[model samples]
Target: MSYDHISESLTLLQKDWSVDPILVDFMLGKRTDVTDHAVKVGQVIFHIPYITGEKKFILWKCYWPDCHNCCERQGRLPLTSDDLITIGKGLKYQKTSDFVKNETLVATWMESGPSGNNVLMTSVNLKRKIDETESDDGTHIRCRFLDEKGACSMHPNRPGVCYLYPFSSWLENETGRARVHSTYQFTGDCPGFFLEGSLDSMKETLKEYSNTIYDYTMKYTRTTREGFSLTSFV
Candidate 1:
């Protein structure tokens, strides 16, 4: 599924809160009032929001095995070049082409370009177990790597999108750094969001997630510009 609407909303929200003291205080854990703020890295707004209510900011902690909501109903898990290489290696595929051909589907969709134009981008998505008896509404599908115990069989070498689960990132402009965003706004069903967690811990997680996303994005941009498909890259 395309995330153009989410990006557009984040862009508008950033504009609205260009100089927000409420968000500042919220980040510092000093605000008791309810409000929403986008997570950011060095002034680059992330799509994830820090939503507060009932005089406290909501925090999240993944409840993986206990709650497999994300894995069960995941819509699209786009794979990056790095993810392809790592997963191919883990699966003992000697050739990336062989792995891609056997394990993934090439998905192409239109998204809003950096300059507000439309661009068609192609990427590889991990294939999911298809249930012929079920409706094709995406709700009945699950990742192929998801095991019976609700654990990822390819945990150590899962795709980049899986690693960044419950969160996503994008560069607002081609020249700017990528910003992090929570997948909460889109999914709205993650049980993790209802639980309480440490703000510092969340920040630390965002730091790692943001860095990984930035690296993957840079590699993706370079590979696409070089006229190589994601699956063809090492």
Candidate 2:
């Protein structure tokens, strides 16, 4: 949870021959050559070239049930319109308004607009439990859906943010073409980093995550631009 621990872990990982040097460098801010390319599953052979200028392989596999750090430490779980609908239905909520009122909280923050000006944006995020859980750093709240067994209660219809844990993406327009660029979200809590993962499974995960992230971003941006309020859901 602290930078000191993260630094120590990176140092320990650096000694492991199984760990990829490029990944360690990237995490240490030593390398900034992260690639912005389309997700091509077929072209991938072994390592994902998320970072260009090198042939290094960085593999990861989620250690869920064993490690619920993401669920416990992730502060904000922003939801898109699709997530609202899907999760609402999954929870047996008769109306989106009811789900929004009972299960979410509206958060307002400043973000850069298209003209590079600061604009206030509001988002609907899944509400966390009120009780605080003590950790090595201090205390933090867990997602309301996270159970005592460290499993998601609404796993089948979890939000896009939950689906894309430890991986975040953004869209960039290059020569009038939209490109989705993804990067590892190193939180120092995920045990999956540097671990072996099946290429086929990784490809499938990337394909779904890529699509979800794109849709989530577009819908979230639209909601922000349209100035949708919590009352609008009703």
Candidate 3:
């Protein structure tokens, strides 16, 4: 009953956090070694709470059309100069692609799914791996994808932990134990996932992925905090 594979599947969000927070929850530690306890968690914004005159055109950039996700002055993702420094420390890039220009990128950005192929600009909306079947069939993670459709055709080549759908992540919890569940949510408003579960349930799933986000954030923070170069840091 473990979905750790998804955790590894996603490269983890390596970028810095915006004030809004991608926001997801998860069990920090393991309740049982072999249990689906080590699951992958994620959460995404599902449109902002408001959209007035100025706010509507705020360029609320977290993906999704009617999504205000979290309107930042510059962008939903708030990566500081240090974060850029850390990014350099962690990965190697020749010429900056959309990530550099956009400035708002996820630790595990993806670009594949059921709808042919279009770069998935955002992170995983919700995920909790548990196979289909009466037995709860392990745990099938439903990584955020097309609205009512399948996922990217090239989903296999997707980067970051996003590819790790239906998976769970392990984090340090208050009781000092990592747990597992079978639900997840998207950050911004999405049409695909808006049934069965309520907002609270979606929030819980998001929290799990958020923790995984922090876990991956460490890699860059460690390097950037040290004033490392892009070559060495990345």
lDDT by candidate, in order shown: 0.57, 0.61, 0.29
> Candidates 1 and 3: which is better by TM-score?
1
TM-score for all models, in order of appearance: 0.63, 0.64, 0.22
Order the numbered candidates by TM-score, best leading: 2, 1, 3
- Write down the TM-score for model 2: 0.64
For candidate 2, write residues 55-173 as lDDT tens digits.
Answer: 43455777765667778766576787878889999989999999888877776655444335665545677677643222211223567788899898898788877876776654457
Off by over 4 Å in 1: 1-58, 110-119, 130-140, 174-185, 195-201, 226-234
Per residue, candidate 1 scores C-alpha lDDT tens digits across 87-192 of: 8889899998898788777665565443457666666666776422213323326777788888889987787666666665444443574442333334433545
Q: Which parts of model 2 are misplaced by more than 4 Å?
A: 1-55, 109-121, 130-140, 195-205, 225-234
Q: Give every collision pair in model 1.
A: 48-181, 48-182
- How much does each candidate deviate from the true structure in C-alpha RMSD? 9.7, 6.9, 19.9
Order of candidate numbers by lDDT, starting with the best: 2, 1, 3
Instruction: Return the top candidate by lDDT.
Output: 2
